[model samples]
Target: MESTTALDPATALEPATALESATALEPATALESATAPESTRTTESSTRATVHRPAGPVAPTDAAAVALRPLAGRAVRLDPDGFLGRWQRRNATETLPHCVTNLERDGALDNLRHAARGERQRFSGKWFADSDVYKTLEAAAWWLGHADDGRLTELLDEVADVLAAAQREDGYLNSWFQLMDPEHRWMNLAVGHELYCAGHLLQAAVAAIRGGVGPRLVEVATRLADLLVDRFGGDGRLGICGHPEIETALVEFFRCTGNRAYLELAAGMVELRGRGWLAEHSVDTGLGGSSFGAAYYLDHMPVREAGAATGHAVRQLYLEAGVVDVAVETGDRSLLAASERIWEDLFATKTYLTGAHGSRHRDESIGDRYELPPDRAYAETCAAIASFQWNWRLLLATGRARYADELERVLYNAIAASTAVDGRHFFYSNPLQLRVDHDGTEEDAARRQAWYKCACCPPNLARLLASLDAYLASSGPDGIQLHLYSAATIATWIGDSPVELRVDTEYPWRGRIAVAVASTAAAGSWELALRVPGWCDRTPTVTVNDEPMDAEASDGYLRLRRAWREGDTVVLDLPMPARLVTPHPHLDAVRGSVAITRGPLVYCLEQVDLPDGVRLDDLRVDPAAAPIPVAIAGLLDVPVGVVAHGFVEPDGEQALYDTRERPPHARRPIDVLTIPYFRWANREPGAMRVWLPTA
Candidate 1:
């Protein structure tokens, strides 16, 4: 595999058939295609897919898959009847939503035609144009499902035609797959984006099929996914994707087509864990004691040993979803425990008030435990959504309230803030503090872009937001657990019995809740539980039918095991108080950094709130200092300690000075307001610090 002077045989061919021949040519081609071709693609009719549309049928072909669209609008592949059923069924009451939406819109669909046309003008090639338009169509499919955008279908057809023309006879479809070394197929799982692109295609195909897809694109994505399974499955030479989406996508694919091979492939791909096979072939760091060394710990996971998350946010979320797959399929306590450890580790230390994770903005990866400085939080919107998705699975697996509690916080703050009023603009990085300038950090642009070096967040957010309906469902045989308290009627099965549950309450306001259950089970015994978040007010008091009852909480869930009538009502109360949370004694970042908490919301300090953009290292604030919540502009505003007054010297601009750390310094008392880092959205963004300085 070493190259010295001569060209590698793989790159020599116009069309590469193997990996060995392309390794050498890749070095040469990397320079020529710093930019890759448009990823839009189409394949011959031979590509196999469960969704068989008449060659020209360009609208909701399979009604069921497309029927349960999210409120955002678009067909999604989410159903609880099949295997790999969604644990967070509450997330998808309308459809199987993905993160991307019209997050840019001021909240209306009218601007899309104008916006799509405007953004289309910004792209260079047709392929790129189509994907950008595809995202618009994807969003258009979900949010504007009823709006007749025949132009979108036409645009998609043209893009498919382009891909059909661009694809070589050998079956590779990535715009960047062989851009440089065409022969390097199936090699370099790290950094290579083919699989991630496949996840997008899968999502896009769901939308296309719903919006009406040409047979060509459907066949293209199906073939690509199948090829992925054939190569990466345990028996196959290729291993799991460096990124995690493929596993989740393939699971959905199995549900859509009832193809056992897809499920088997998912199992095979996951089974390859702990073996250093994939990393060994590529430029990966192989396995590691820390999550950072591996590709988000795909090298060793529930597919292997349950390990803590260490790498990129997206990879961790994807891998966690895959692990959920393993845990449910095999009922392995080992995998379940691993997920618990990860959850406990994050909640006990790293999670932001806004439920954001990851500290380093540059890498979008989780930093050391409790190293969650608000100024540096890289909590991407998709990461928060994915984290909630993972937590939802954990809740269903273990029936733990902590998981559901965490999911609720992220869903309300970080995940929901991702979309704008119109639902098109998205906040990529959900920080803990506010800044004054536009940033280079990830996830800032509100609308979809043609491409970014790291483009995972856009489609990921799109897919999650689009499929939001699939996340909200009732599962397990015992009974349904009303984890969230929204006033909605959700119908799901809890055995052969169809359970229609009605929730009536304004949560996060009055902890008081009323659950109306409608089901007939012959007066038998069943346990219907409700989640009690950590922020509950003074040992929650619950009554079953307006009478005082002993509904004790054990392990964060209030378990009620008594027979009741169909019309019986259960009322529970939770108290929300403005409290303060300190860091673990051993952690350096949050030691002085005290977070203000009211219910699930966490608060922090912003450098913008400080003078001269103070570098948020460590502060010397007293541990006894208490912040107070004040009424501001009709919202709760926490008045934290005033920023210590300090003045810049005469020569503050000088790189190095002879005397002290700057000049005529003056003490200024600055009024600093604080809120959850995730809520610091839609502003000129930059770095923020969650931990504060204790005097």
Candidate 2:
């Protein structure tokens, strides 16, 4: 259906209920990895029992603590392979390089040049700061080992060299620090991303180190963490990060290296957030709102409670990430529930037809209902990525299909369409409509420009595409449930045993998937759960190894308890058809209108698709008419396009409704393809709508 609309957890133990979704949480990752032979391990991918992979590492209460950084570092994690392909270098390189390089050409790099010479000012994007140094190096480090091309590694090293050159004697490094607060170094934990950025760098270093290369960045992060611990202790001057992302990041670091001091340091930061001791007094320096958003990103709530999704998108994502720690680690389902409740409300209210969000650029706050103004929508590329990551984690916690469903929506519609397929350009606001040059001024330009001078999107996408290793985790005490199916293989330790899985399928298009489980143990007690997309037929004939089976189905998963060897196959049919879907009657804009859709794909009519001056709500599809499916080039791929000339009923001969001059109406074909309501402006900035009247 055309209007087929798009699509977190925590610790404080706020309520008894958690969020509802498509997947259910499997038993916790209790399998110790010490029982396997040197060649194999107690992989979480055991075919012996049904199993699920939780989002990230499970540690609650102190999840927001600074320790999670190292912990995530040491552990091998997964991200859906096709899930984040939107950020791939091949997909986004063209647009992003121009954005970052602009600063190099402009005097913006002069600011970095000044920082190189001991000067700094209001900086927008992170470049060669102490915090970014480790991360940039770590990224380059990974490229050094994994990438086929050596040039990328060199560029990363060059950036790292610049960052290392800008460091201060006591180990404090922030471009803003050098210019604005050299004397105030390490004074404010809550506001200073000095530590938070450092945490990312630490993570990058760890990723690089574990990949079997890049030790320099690792040492740099360790030293920086040491300095942070020294400065933020009970006796030290600061306690929290003004931005909050660093605390969770740091804790991940601690988990990886087993550094107790970092763990204690991370706790102090988290505690400071709850106590509000870091912001002792608000700074009036234009960044207060951003800081408040930042604080929430830390999930400062000691007790989890449900509320609306408000504030800036990035900050809110940070908050949800922190709270997820509280939920999984502490076993406080309520804290997780609170996160889920808020997220559900947010999704229901704020999400756009394209699964894009971030409406207001002024405060970067979530905007009003039905308030998806095309030109001004501020759905940042990073925001879409954040939403997917958070939801993916929740999918791990609850094992809900809704999480995966929403994740799929964002990945395909919002995230995928953010940048051009070439990986070079980007649109900060991925509105349904596209205007030629609406991005004016620094603020407006931030939305319109192919890339911002800040230039975080390119590297972000680059890194994500390069190391897409961890998303497909499997095996549990029971059996296995597939959360995401992209053609990829994962090799890692699951439960004190080494297991491998090769997932083969052209999913979202076809339902049948064959999974190759490489483990010594015979698969048993494990119930294989596969998601049947809601947009597809509710019931499918699920067969295991060509035998029809009675499956346990709910939300979207078709479950089958089976016994298996290495090569196992599960198959089903996902019907793709054209249908008209109507919105809730209460939705005033689309009260009488219906949307066109095929399978999970939502279709709309652009001016390019339709020939005449046709209004969006003026046309409709006959419920009984089968839309002619056509293959047309879309923003991302060759999508299945539908063609219809007119409504089911015939037109009149310029006569009044009851004038007795009209003949019986005849059904007309919908020859005009409706563009998505959001894709209205591809041809010069104008108007586009998704709703159409009845045939």
Candidate 3:
């Protein structure tokens, strides 16, 4: 039986209707709504009058500036039985509760409590411990918007009250600073994370207001934001944080309230980057900091002048997300173009086959071009989440299928792989390969843990999963566009009429999509756009009500325009064939290897799947024999296992280096069984390799 907490749009818990009440909390402000000219202002009050609430976290005020507009959070929902829906269920039932428990266990909650009491004591956990609490708050706000859970709701109310108590009169509210170092507030811009923490608090506040939660949290965050504007706004301090989270968060806050100060502040911070703002500060060897100069903090060069993705992976991606947000809001074309160039460079030379980033484990930074190494991959889980966020913003900005493609790729492989099947454990860093000789002793080993000292990835995953349905599809003036396919119901307004659609599919496993138009208020002409995934090399077959209708796809979207819709179904068949993918020729680490893929799921060979004594390093797959799909029962019910023909190489253990000579030993033929990359490390901890050597 489905859990009682299953997210149903019919339930009264739906927050979309809660926006009208929440809008009362927004404070009135005289600041300009945006940095754009008077003719192009994208203020919330003037442009987005029809939207009941901001669409998810990346809502842009001006819908005309972008090609596609995201549906409001209460507008769409995922079916409880679908793949994403099941994961979201796990997130709510297991992952979110775990985070709440850990937050209390790890002293995060007490930190705020102690601050509220004005008691002086040593700070607990990392300096950024407050961020975890804020992220969980955001997740709870979103979940409460969609479903009603007594425990989570109570927790939200309690946290808001505590935050309100702890906040200083002037609006500053970092627990670490309040408890440990109040005298040095905002002194260490490079490593203090003051702005970063403030950004997350603002994000949580935005989620609360949009999710139809209480007003106290929003009031507290507003005070802090006002303080930030006073301290760092146009005529104030000229600095940028070592982290890049504040810019995007400020923009969202601006969208939630009609405060133009937030948008201009975010834009100014983005413009301040790459101008050596943090060069004078000594290198702080912290979790995300590095000794690799200003680039590690994204302060090496002007964001517009930077040609390729550089420095820490999460910082780089987060900065890009903020840049895109600023560009869309301010009508700055150059910033968007700059982000596009870096994105192209990233995929061309930096990204791994599993859509993961970060190649160096030393500083948790993306390595130089073509420096990818599978065994040494530092694909931090937070980086993958950051990448997904950046892609979503880019998708909204350009309405390009390629951005959606990357979003799907990372969600299925990297982001999904971060959590265990049970959802209680998580991986901080995701490497493509785990060598057989690996001891699995370090935190970055092939095993997932219940919690970590950093603990950033767990809560981050919680928030992403909590609000995932918002990314399923989007709407525009003409009609709607389906980006990620799954079993769901989407209802949104197109002009003066209401359009509702029901999508049925077991996507990434089976590709037959049946989009049934449940109802439409208007019988006039309107269009429905469906994305043709970039991974599908074969032509997709589309039909309207069982009648084949041929139409060329434009910009990766197949559009169908019709005058009337009632009980009309559109079926799209995308052939799912297992294929081998090779890396760029310049990637020397995996030069002679290929990864197995079907649909968007990347496949890998695990030690448990091999015969006794068969080593992953000694096997070579034959690309000529195509991979075949077979039924499996371990991970997901709908997914299938892949089988490929391969042979074992002769033993070469005699020497580290040998002369060029052919061995006489005969090779052993074998049938290699590969499972989805996200499913590995679930059964047992052992060798796992995504890119297998190909013959």
lDDT of each: 0.51, 0.51, 0.82
312 Cα displacement, candidate 1 (Å): 2.3
Quick one: best lDDT, which candidate? 3
The reply for model 3, stretches above 4 Å from the true place, is 1-54, 281-290, 634-638, 660-662
Better of 2 and 3 by lDDT: 3
TM-score comparison, 2 vs 3, better candidate: 3
Residues 1-695 of candidate 3 have per-residue lDDT tens digits of: 11112222233121122212221111111011111122323343221212235357778886427878888655666777667877998999999999999999989999999999998865679889999999999999888877888898789889989999999998899998799878777777778888999999988887887776757788888888888888888835756898889999988888777678888899999988998988664344333344578888999899999999989899999999999998999999999999999999998889988889999987789999999999888899999999999999999889999999999999999999999988999998898999988975455777899998888899999999999988989877788889998777676666766666777776767777888877777758888889988898888889999999884688888999887577899988887778989888899999898889988999999998888888888899998998876655535453467788899986665467788675665688898778899988988778999999985
Clash pairs for candidate 3: 32-260, 274-301
* Residue 458 displacement in candidate 3 (angstroms): 0.6
lDDT of 2 by residue, 1-695 (tens): 35212110121112211112112112122112111122221222111111022112222223432111111111222222332322333432443344345545544444545666765565545433333333334445443443344554555555555555665666555676676666665554445566667766766755654444544445556666667777765635545555545655665555445455665665555445545555554443323334344334443444254366766676576556656654565566776777788688778878765566778777566666655554577777667766776776677667777877777677666666555544555555565443323345543442334545555544454444444333343344454556655554444333343444445554543444555553425433455567776666545666666777765467667777656556565665555556677665544544665667655556666544543544343456555555555544544343345554465343446454465756765555555665433233334433344445555
Compute the lDDT of residue 175 as modeled in candidate 3: 93
Lowest lDDT 10-mer window, candidate 3?
25-34
Among the numbered candidates, top TM-score falls to 3
Stretches of model 2 off by over 4 angstroms after superposition: 1-148, 186-196, 234-242, 261-279, 284-303, 330-334, 368-376, 434-448, 492-500, 516-527, 585-593, 596-600, 612-629, 632-636, 644-669, 674-695
Q: What is the lDDT of candidate 3?
A: 0.82
Lowest summed lDDT window (length 10), candidate 2: 45-54
Residue 249, candidate 3: C-alpha displacement in angstroms: 0.3
- Which stretches in model 1 have alpha-carbon errors above 4 Å? 1-171, 178-181, 203-219, 233-236, 283-303, 331-333, 336-353, 417-424, 434-453, 494-496, 517-526, 561-567, 604-677, 681-695
